[model samples]
Target: MLFLFFCPGSFGADTDEVFVMEGDSVSLTCLKKNQQDRIKWYYNDIRIAQMNGDPSKTCTDVQCNEGTERFRDRLKLDHLTGSLTITNIRDTDAGEYKLLITRGNSDSEKIFSVSVHDKVFVMEGDSVSLTGLKKNQQDRIKWYYNDIRIAQMNGDPSKTCTDVQCNEGTERFRDRLKLDHLTGSLTITNIRDTDAGEYKLLITRGNSDSEKIFSVSVTGVPAAEQDEVKRKTVKEGESVTLDLDVKRNPNDVMTWHFNDILIAEITEDQSQICTDFQCENGEERFRDRLELDHQTGSLTIMNTRNTDSGEYKLKINSISRRRRRSVSSEKRFDVTVTASGLSSGAVAGIVVVLLVSALTAVGVGVIYHRHRSPRKAVEEKQRASVESPNKEKEIFLQTQIEIT
Candidate 1:
């Protein structure tokens, strides 16, 4: 977060430009000094703060304007110097501010123009547009990559040009650039590794010009080299290793970046090795879970989580002793981490099989009992007929009694 201050002589209506990030503080100073001078600040033509010669009549922030809460309590005014400080600024704060100084019967105004910059991240083959313009704007817009003009649009007739069209015979971004004629926004399609760099958008409207910068980072390798990237799939809580598969040199410096963020690094001769926060703060996602092979520079991730699924890129820079140049190479790995349990479909299939097996067993037992009962009753009748006359008579009487 950088704060830029440009103070012009406070007599005429000169404009000063300031650039800052969101959530940053900016001070718009009124350089004119007079004991009896009164100062008032206006944002987009709305009064936001004021300082009077009478100490009891001074007001700042919400006290200045009760009808609007845009500034809230984030505004501060210096009673002595008449400088206005805005704390915790937001995107809406990027606009024009006016400071009026009154001395006796004369009044002078100073203008402050503020702009906020942003960062953008994308994967290879994706499209992203840099935006900072209003609809139907008539300003002349120019887009530059690393300070080289890449695209532009003119207000008159809404003419637009890109890449080789913008600069003669330059085909670096021939078919990948798109410029919006309406809003003057620049879009890059089928983005590549060579397209990852700082982009500046300069808007020229009349005599006042405002610039916005965007830091673009592409995650994966180029489309032509996409087949070379290694892909791995692992279950949760499992460990996966991404092997460099190349012999390590004593003068080689290896670095590993996850989603374009540095997470592990090893210096020449393996003298210094760091992982996660040891390499960069606020990178605790892989804390205590990353390991690097000292000999081959391979990376091993332990206890992997679903959040760890992304692109991991390795860059190796080898310093040549005889040759005064360094050789560099990069390798990418796409990892997919899945949950460590059976899928719902698989579990349902197993349950259905168990239920079918139980039903089949019950049907077989019932059929077997029905077939054996008739044969057993016939065998009992034959034994009774073969008995003696007296025993037969007794059996006949017992059967008659059971019948009755």
Candidate 2:
């Protein structure tokens, strides 16, 4: 970096901008038509250090010995004039540094100051989540991706800005990620492993900055499989299907077992035997009596009898190795064989006894009513006489004779 130092009284220069870098070596050159070589360097308005005055004796001795030990050997000077070179600058060097030159009663001086800056990235999640941001709303913090500004700090709810293509479109987020500008927190639901990457954050308050970084994580749930067993109590020779309702991935192969025995390998298709039952033991009593309901995953028992009562178990197998077999609950169906014609006879006997008792109660009510009504019979005779048409005509004739 090049730096030129001149005084306000000097006629040889324009452009008052002075560039100073912290912790870096800097040289300020003052060009002159001729040189008397009276040079001095000052910090702020105070005279802190100066070079050994000489005209042609090689380089002058550095005067950094006048300041603190931190600036030792960090300062150098040319033998010509008031040009000052500061090497290995520090924060203490941020104050104004001035150089004054006098060559034949002509004088010049230049003063300037400097500051050093550093960038710090602070990110919270594997994905984009702005959690625990101090003054997230009005703070003028610039956002960057690979050091490129996509948007500026504007604390308005109507302002909506996000990556449309981050991790293959925002559609995958689907209510999973909640971006709240008011709180400056990005919450992600059902986060998967693919959402891990590098992120950067740059906070600025008139060039004063600080940052934080954090990692987000997710947990996994174990794989599960289930079996379904159904049982029914059917009358002898009654056809009833026991359905198995199962919820599992297609990678699992569902199976069934009846009466503690597997299904035998058979060539016939149209039988009560379920197709999915694999027979390993011969104890299966309903060998051919059990049939598979192909449409629904159920075992149909055709002509079920009293002998088919027992505990039944349903087994499920997984075609994929990643899944494990889980059996359904044990189902018990008690079969009681009703004697031939016994139920019908009992029903018929109940009907007959009910009808006879009803008729006897009604007859007794009629007889009792007649015996309890002697006064009713006399009232009936009087009512019959008064209501006769002949009696009415005689009464009307009497009334006519009286009126005449």
Candidate 3:
């Protein structure tokens, strides 16, 4: 799994981005004020380690039982201070690293970013070294071929492996690959043409992942030999002719298959037995629609249907005049039958309906505007007429006060 780092800053800080060359070690600190609570470590949202709640029973580094396989032995958990130290990082290990600690009823979290650089080269039948960037710690390297796990080197939590216990790879890589247990570098010997593809190294430590991708290409692949597949598209209910162009012979044998099911066969004596069309053993699906041209061994369907769209295979056996055995050859044809689109009459009907609907909408809008304009004018005139009486009453009151 690859992760996108979301936190900011680089190195040392609580939410920092740590950049390291492909095979270096980095330490991520998780400080907690509460010493009695358990400390949990997560990488890209996956919980990788959790210490016992009691700090007295906690050790310096304890491997977790349940988590991602990439983090198996690379984590050095500090039970005393809740810090993590990762060794021998690979490029894949770059991502978000998080630490969770709870004290009393309050919880705290710390997130960091780690990036590892990866470099690779392609070669045929040559050994390649993927440096783990850390030395003497032999437990955190895993190699994968095309995303399938091929090998891994790991050791016990109490001590690093001086004599590495690396597991054998899958069947395709058996006895061909080797890993340096001390530094986490992978070397494959006796590389073959089939081994040309993607290889990845996943180094996980401090609850984070570093990855390296290697692409390999090999020369010398035999050229493929096969007849070109002929393609044809025909409208449904139309006539279609499939040409075989084989000359009839006394010892010649011919067979026809539709989608790999034998539909017709011709014996060496020029006798035909068929479940397809125009033969003695006729099938119901193709009964009256099929016709066979005996001289050229061609098949013609008068009314092609959508169900007839499929691959058609023709096999011919040419019998040598001197030898008793026959040499077989085959040709393939792909036929597609499609429905002819809507007719002109149907299109005309649809256009007529659309035009009528548009005109009706326009007429309705015009009628609404014409009726609403007069009503609006009448309401405004009535409002002006009502305000004139109030204005006259106010003037009369002022005149009476002046006279008094």
The prediction achieving the highest lDDT against the true structure is: 1
The C-alpha TM-scores of every prediction are: 0.47, 0.28, 0.28
Q: What is the lDDT of candidate 3?
A: 0.62
| Candidates sorted on lDDT, descending | 1, 3, 2
Residue-wise lDDT of candidate 1 within 1-404, one digit each (tens)?
42536475445756877876656888888675588988888888888888787776678756765325777788888777888888877656778988898889998888988875454666676566666655346688888888888888775553477888775326897687777777677777767888888888898888878777777778885655554447888998889999866678878888899999999998774446888888854388887999988889899999899999999988776655532233344667899999989756789999999999999999999888777656655555567778766766666666555444
lDDT of each: 0.76, 0.47, 0.62
**Candidate 2 lDDT tens digits, 1-404:** 43445544543434344444434566665554245556666666555455434434323233334444435566666655445677765434545666666667777665555332211122221122433344444554433333333223445534444444232234434555554455433444334554433223345555566432223333332332111222245566666665545444444333454455554222223343334333444454665676754444456667667666665544433232321112111223333433234456688999999999999999999888766555555455456568996765665555455434
RMSD per model, one decimal: 18.8, 30.7, 35.6
| Candidate 2: segments with Cα more than 4 A from true spot | 1-23, 32-35, 52-70, 113-404
lDDT score, residue 334, model 1?
93
Off by over 4 Å in 3: 1-229, 245-250, 268-282, 342-404
The alpha-carbon root-mean-square deviation between model 3 and the true structure, to one decimal in Å, is: 35.6
